[model samples]
Target chain A: MSGAFYLATRYMRRHRGKTAVMVAAVTLTLLLPLAVTVLVRAYDRQLGERAAATPMVVGAAGNRYDLVLQALYFRAGRVGTVPASLADDAERDGMAVGIPLHVRYTAQDAPVVGTDLAEYAAFRGLTVAEGDWPRMLGQAVLGHDAAERLGLGPGDTLTTDQQNLYNLARNMPLRLRVVGVLAPTHSPDDRAVFVSLRTCWLIGGHGHGHAPEIHDDEALHRAARLAVEVTEDNVDSFHFHGDMDALPLSAVIVLPDSDKSRTILTARFNQATPGVQALDPPTVMDELMGLVFRVKRFFDANFALVLLATGLLLGLVVTLSLKLRTAERRTLHLLGCGRWLIVQTQAIELGLVLGLSAALACGLAGALTLLAPRWLGV
Target chain B: MIELTDVRFRYDASASGAFELRVDRLALGAGSRTAVVGPSGSGKTTLLHLIAGILTPVQGRVVVNQEELGGLPDAQRRRARLRSMGMVFQDIQLLDYLSVRDNILLPYRLGGGLVLDREAKDRAESLANRVGLGDKLGRAIDKLSQGERQRVAICRALIARPELLLADEPTSALDADTARATLNLVFELAEETGTTLVVLTHDPSVLERFDRVVHVDGGGVS
Candidate 1:
């Protein structure tokens, strides 16, 4: 056996170029299918874990996928808004706790999540890893990845991105002070910047603070481009002009007291409200993943065919190689080589090729799976 | 010593015509240097293979080293040939992927009942040095000249210190100077080891150097 192995190693080393090409071909053939399976499993677990945690989502009557995605992942779509008062109505009915969401803007390309920090943080199991929560108006708390990406910590300031620079009616960008950073949750929450709902409304031009000397209404009617910074000294002057209950919210995440309460609340919002719709997040996510898995099945079939073709090609290569080595085999035979030894030598060579290719495929697959979250921004 | 009595062998019939060889009786003494001179398609290589137990005859007994190979099983016959004989093929068939040293050590790796130890390796290197290939042991077969490759083949055949050495056209493709040197090396090694030597050749100049000459024509040896 050792003698057979020695000859096999020598042959492979001497013809290293052919060996390397064969190894690479087999590695890619194994890597493609292995990498796809690993990535799909990771996606399934990640999506399922997050979706199963949220109970229901209420938003404008439009694409329910958009509403659930906006409520859970803060991925804004074309879905319109619902009244912020819906959260209070759900709480008042003693059925469920509603966490209102206002996900209209971005800060440094990270979604800005405007909600009640005390309630939303508890609901999502978010805790401050550094400094305090967003306590004052215009104060911001960043998620772990958000803080790392923005390179901001406590006492630093962040500015919201302006939606339109040319429009005169658009609100001026707000400069927010970073107060805290949340620990990693490994969800979409890690990519968000959390702030108070009033601060978000202020950024939307619903409120402003001005110089104390401007006492006249005509002076108060300044252009929307006039920027505002809420400092501790002038924070008391900032107030909203419209009814607070009529404020726009992108979606509401409802956590019910029981199965009965959930069914009643879902019915109340889905049937009674004219333009508002409530949906189960897990059901919507399952349908979406079903489509994703259907596509994966097609890819799996294609990879199977590729593997078959690779196998056939490898078979042809081995056959041709044996044919080419007929003279060499005869030489070994005349040199007193046994028939069994010849077969053993060639078998060991094939085993070495396949073993190296399998190891490379596994290493590459594991690396790609580990990097999928960072690459896909999960 | 080797003996063949009434050996009759025929090639399998194909598109090419069938040919047969018949040797009524032939005897080669121990440590004798003999030459087999034959025309093309006259079965010189077939005669060498028969003496080495590589081919079986229809109605004859091939006795090599005092064992009748025709009565032995296939495996025992192979073992006897591997242990007691060495052969150099007509084409100098060295594996192209191996270096000169490995090509010389191939018999020990081929399950030939030879143990490959440090002493065996030393003997292989020593034979290569004797054949003027000591410095070129690490070079690939394709990198060597035709004469150098022929010398390597001779070294491989002699590495086992076999009692009998059979060579087919060992110097056929060499220039006169290299051919003489290669033949001289073979004679020196065989004489030093007291090995029986049989060489098949078509060159007339090679006949005078042997103790006895056998001629084959029309599938019969005289």
Candidate 2:
């Protein structure tokens, strides 16, 4: 066995060029499958972790995926805003409501979100990396990635666009100070800036020239304009910045009071609602993953075909090589070599080629895993 | 020592029974030099092959020392051939990829018994010098002329200093001078090592140098 290995090594060295080419081909074949397997598994694990961390998400009635993307990921899309009465309705039924007043704006490509401090604990589950969460109307808290990208920390001021940053059609910029930085979290929360929901209303009310400057106690009492009113007395008094009949909101996140209340509310809303839909997040995510898996299966099938063809080509090459060396083989036989020895030599040669190719494939797979994301813009 | 008894062999059953060769009995003792000469299709090469254990006779008892070649298993026969017998073929069969020295080391590698020991290497160098391939030991076999390659083969056959040496038409492709020198070197080396020597050829010049001559006709010893 050792002698066979030695001979195999010698033979490989003698034909190093051909062996290298074989190794490269094998490496590429092996690497594609290995990298895909690892990447897909890792991505699945990350997605599962994120989903499990949030028990349930309530969003506006529309495309479930669009609602989830806007509510959870802060991505640009159609949004629906439910009345503040929904929070009271949920709390009355015994559930905690973390209402987020989303304001779509960006500073240097990072989304800035305006929501109450409860949103930090509710939606993001964030912990302070430095300083404290924003308390003042003009102050902001940065997510890990947002801070890292903008090189901002607590006490550093950042500017926000007046309109959606992703859509440059409306260029509205707002200057705000960074009050805190959040710890790293591998979720959508890693890329957002958080502020009090009142700040969002302030920005929206500013468009209507409704900035109130209180000079004295008399003026302060009158300066208290109703921006968002949930109480019965002010419910009809809250002013809508846009057409009251066709108000636009990206999405509204809901939290039901109890399991019973969740079913009752869902039934009631589905029966009488207009321009609203309730969706189970996990179901929508599963449908999306099914589409992804279908695409993956297509790629896997194509790769399998290529792998099979390469195997056949390898077999053909080896057979032809042995046939071409028949005269040399016969000479060795006449020199007292047994038929088994010649066969064993050929087997060892093939094994070496395969082993080297597998090793190269592993190396190529690792390289691809490390480099592909950036190149493919992932 | 080598012995053959009732060695009846046929190339094919379709040929005439006159094509058969029967050597009732023949014994070549240690330190003996025997030459075989015959016309074409006379089975000289077959006899050499049978003696070298390269072929099995249909009915025969070929014994080298106490081990019977016809009775031994295939693996043992190969081992015995590699360790104890040396052969120089009619066509020089040196490995084209390896240098002359590496080719000489083939038997030791195949047997897995000995490294290139100092004495064996020295013998190889000396034999190469004797065959006028002193400076060509490092050269690949393909680069050498036919006569040069034959000299390399002769050196390889003597490298392990086997107990038996077989030469088949070693000088068939050489000039007269080179042939005479090659035969002289082979005989001198065999005598010096006190090894049994067997030569198979149609040329009569080699017969004059051997202790005994065996002639074959119609595949039978005559």
Candidate 3:
């Protein structure tokens, strides 16, 4: 056995180029399916965990997938919003604890999610890792990756990206001071910036504040061009117009106290409630992931075909290689090598190549698995 | 010592045509250097193969060192050839992938009958040194000159310290001077190891160096 090993190793080393080509071919053939399988599994695990944790979402009666995506992942794509009054009404009706979410804005390209941090952060298990939560208007807390991406810590300020860079009549961007950084949740939260709902409303041009010296008229006109920055001196002066009940919320996360409450709430909000629909996030996620996996099934069949073709080609290559080594085999035979020993030597050479290829394929698949969630922006 | 009596050998008649070798009697004493001279198609290589037990005679006895090779099974005959006999080929069939040192120690790796210990390695190195290839022991076979390759083959044959050494046109691929030099090295090594040497060649100029000469023609040896 040792003799066979030595001979096999020497032959492989001497013909390293051919050996490397073989190894690379087998590694790539194995890696394609392995990487996809690992990455999709990681994606399924992360999306399932997050969806399973949040029970329900309430939004404007429209595409349920968009509503759930905005509520769970803070994805921005003009998913119509429900009135903010729904959260208050749901709370007052004793149906569930409703936390309003406004996700129509961004700061430094990261989603700026507006909610009552006291309730929303606790509901989502978010804790400040660096400083404090956003306690005042114009103060914001950064998620872990958000702070790292923006290169900001406590006391640093960030300005929201203007909705339309060419439009001058719209509300100028709001500059919010970074009051804290949140611990990593490894979810969409890690990529979001959190602020109070009032701050979110202010950024949406619903309200503004002025210096006491400037009259309200001039300040109102100047608010369109000048960026808004809320400070201790001017925070008390800021207020809103219009019916507060009609303010828009992207979605609301509802936490029912009991299973009966959940049943009652789903029935009332989905059917009896006007202009609103309630949805179970896990069901919606399952539907969405079902489509994803259906597409993966096609890929799996395609991969099977590719693996078969590669295996055939590899067999052909091994056969040709053996044919080329006929003279060498004859030499060994004349040197008193038995038929079994010659076959053993060739088998060992092939085994070494496959072993190395398997190790490489595993390493590449592992790396892709670890990075898949972040790549999909889970 | 080697002996052959009434040996009749032939390949498959249908596949290989009418090639046959018939020898009534031939004997080679121990430590004697004998040369078999023949034409291109005169069965010189077959004679070497029969003596080395690589070919089984259809009829007759081939006994080497008092053991009859024709009576042994395939595996035992192969073991006996590996342990007691060494062979050098016309093409100096050294594996191109191996360095000179590995090529010399190939017998130990090809069959498990001999253990390739430090002693085997030292002897291989000493044999290579005797053939003027000590410094180039790590060189690839393709990198060596034709004369040097022949010297490596000689070292490989002597590495097992076999009782008998067979050469099939060993120096055929070399020039006259290198061939003479290579033949001299083979004779010197065989004498030093007390190995019975039988060389097959068609080059008559080198016949004088052997103790006796046998000629094969028209499928018969004299």
Docking class of 3: medium
Please identify model 3 stretches exceeding 4 Å from their true place: A211-227, B13-16
Interface RMSD values for all candidates: 1.3, 2.3, 1.1
For residues B1-222, could you state the per-residue lDDT of candidate 2 as single tens digits?
899999987777535444567888989999899998988778898888888888778898999877889898887787777778889988777766567877776666565255667877787778887878889888877789888888888777777778999999888888888788878888888888887999987777567789889887777875
Per-residue lDDT over B1-222 for candidate 3, one digit per residue giving the tens place of the 0 to 100 score? 799999999876635478889999999999999999988878888889999889989999999999999999878888888888888999888999999999999999977489889999999989988888889989999999999998998888888899999999998899999999999998998998899999998788888989999999978999
| Chain B, per-candidate TM-score | 0.96, 0.92, 0.96
Let me know the DockQ for model 3: 0.72
**Residue pairs clashing, model 3:** none
lDDT of 3 by residue, A1-378 (tens): 577898999999999999999999999989998988887788778888889999889889989988888889988776887888988866766868999999999997899999989999889999999999877889999999999998999999999998888877778799999999999999999999999999999999888786677678887775555577999988998888998778899999999988999988898898898889999999999999898889889999999999899889988998999999998999888889899888999999999989999999999988888788888788
For model 1 the local lDDT of residue B71 reads 85
Better lDDT candidate (2, 3): 3
- Among residues 3 or more apart in sequence or in different chains, the pairs in candidate 2 whose N, CA or C atoms overlap within 3 Å are A27-A361, A61-A277, A79-A249, A79-A250, A79-A251, A80-A250, A80-A251, A161-A172, A162-A172, A162-A173
Ranking by lDDT: 3, 1, 2
Ranked candidates, highest DockQ first: 3, 1, 2
Q: Candidate 1 — which residues are off by over 4 angstroms?
A: A165-169, A209-230, A233-238
Q: For candidate 2, lDDT tens digit of each residue in A1-378?
A: 444555567667767898888877877887777877667655555455555444344445667777765666677665666544444443444544535446455666777676657754556568989989776565778888788889999878776654543753442454567878888876767778887665555444433233344478756554443222133333233344643323323444555556666676666556656655655556666676677778889889988998998899889889898897787687667666777777887898898788877877777767766664333221
Residue A41 miss distance in model 3 (angstroms): 1.5
TM-score of each: 0.93, 0.73, 0.94
Over all chains combined, what TM-score does candidate 3 have? 0.94
- Per-model lDDT: 0.88, 0.70, 0.90
